[model samples]
Target: MTAAVLSVEKFTVSMPDATASTPALGLGQDIDNCVPFMTVSSDNEANEAQMVDVKKNGGTNKFDFTATALGARDLEVTVVEFDPAQVTIEEVSFTLGSGLTANVTVGTIVEANTFPIVYAHSAGDTTDGYDHVMMRATFTSTTNLQIIKQVHQADLVGHAYILEALNGQWSIETGASIPLAYTTAQTTKNAAITVTANRTGLWSYWDTSDIGDDPRDSIWDGVITDATNLDLTRANGSTPSADGDIESFVVNFAADVAVVQQGEFNYVTAATKTAAISAPGTLGNTMVVATNAYGWCESTGVTVARATCQGRMTFNSAIEVLGTRSGFGNGEYRQNFQVIEWLIGGAAAAAEPIIIMLGY
Candidate 1:
């Protein structure tokens, strides 16, 4: 035998305050404060338009037909058991919108209240099915609140309204399950490096001066002679033979010597020259050398040299950066059911209607 699948296993009803400033009925509410009741069964009557056929006296065939206008729909609920101790008798005795009207007691009117109601269905014995099915409606005690006492149980009957299409009196929605979280992949880009400077200088010297004195003194004198020259070459003394004589000079500079070198050089003097140097264009006469001298140069007004590198940014997919997800359908539908009116009353016997209708 094939097993039958039950779409709805059970149902629940929630009641909300009708006296709220903006009373929203039949969407969802906190059921913790509501009185608990066991419902035996429930049913509904759509009460759609009724068609009337018109026939002509001259012919046996059918003629034109007209349909009666649609009216309010009905939903009946049969409750078998409820807790009477949870509510006070004085609170249930007064009927809503009836100026505290009282009803004739058959045994004892346990409870009564007027409010908007929401009906929800639970999926039973199905994995791939709707999550919830909710419907909105209202109950009034002036028309249909019935109570009957049996041997051990009392039956309470009430009616819900599905009024006009303008108010959206009755609506049912089925919600499907959807995903909540998503995963996204992204990519990083490569960085670039940059270098900057105010000026660059290169200096080269070929030492050719005598070892007894500082050869760098001639480079300093030459720098003083031409402070603005970018490429300056200067020698310390005249050319010497293969004897113990050292020659030194300096070359290129991007800026002025005083600006690059900052100041003059201070040196310690030697006791005597290692070898006496003949004066230029003199006959056998020797020139005396005393202290040692040195010079150094650097570029000026260079605040920064290099800059930090930056990388190009990329993404694996457009959706990753856009924050859009895939494989999930539309989410739940949550529209509150609108209620026009609410009524509350008590019934003497189960045979009589719980609600008494004064007029349509």
Candidate 2:
């Protein structure tokens, strides 16, 4: 019968061994917190395959045979093959198209350079071989043999130096910072004619003398032979013993900066110091006076009264105030009021009928 000319496609079924059986393997379901995941790289790109949650307590759940036919696919299985091995989720291929395109910015690198000092001093100015850098400084001294010293460097904010001994034998050690030096009575020891801004500080101890000498009275002079950031207070912050211990303080880095607008103090409070008046003058209290009393509320612990506001402060008297104004930039203070424009009525006045503008 010619064996029926059969082309057989054999299907073999292997019976389980005589032992415990293996559980069925999960297909598309994921694993909890994923255990023993496999990572592989194809073209410098890596992917992972892990366990997935199937959400089945070994129940007859319908399995979806859908496959990820697109980008960056990862495969995971929840259940391991134990008994009744069945579904095999072999290889998972991905097509990561336009998924990870990023715009990276790369910055260019730069290098640096250096420079030199514009004002350096000289070295060695003594019989005792001590190298001293030199620079012209403005210094001031007093006749009180107890001469007050001041030091002003070209670079005020640069270095902190002091002048210990002024004129050899004068054993004086100056403070590092300059105490403010403004007074009703200017002092001989105040900022000198040749030396202003130069204050003194003996930030360090000197073994030898660099100071020149005193000509006659406790009166003396100094040769700003040195300039250094090393405690070189080359000027004096002292008020003449004559100026009283006027509680000298400094307009420190903390002190309010001079606010300049039309150049003035804003909340300026000036008074004629009437040995009998009270309330502050409103901005309109313009009763033309005789002189310009450019008075601002300045508390001079000690009373400093003007002889009289009669002649100096009248209808023609003028004043101005400047302080920080908004719509503007910096905190400023300037002389907005110059007593020069002061005018008492008399006849030809701008604010006719002598309208006086009081307390700027």
The lDDT for every candidate, in the order shown, is: 0.16, 0.17
Summarize candidate 2's per-residue lDDT along 1-360 as a digit string, tens digits. Answer: 011001101111111111111122223323211111111001100001000111222243221111111112121111111111111112111111122111111111110100001111111112111111111121222200011112121111111111121112111223212232223233232321111112211111111112221101111112222222211111123321111111111111101111111111222123221221121122221221110011111111111111110011122222332121112211111111111111111223233221212111
Q: Tell me the number of clashing residue pairs for each predicted model.
A: 16, 72
lDDT for model 2, please: 0.17
Measured over all alpha carbons after superposition, the RMSD of each candidate to the real structure, in angstroms, is 49.0, 40.8
Q: Predicted candidate 2: what Cα RMSD to the true structure?
A: 40.8
Locate the minimum summed-lDDT window of 10 residues in model 2.
44-53
* 10 residues in a row with least lDDT, candidate 1: 305-314
Model 2, residue 61: what's the lDDT?
29
Model 1, residue 354: C-alpha shift (Å) = 37
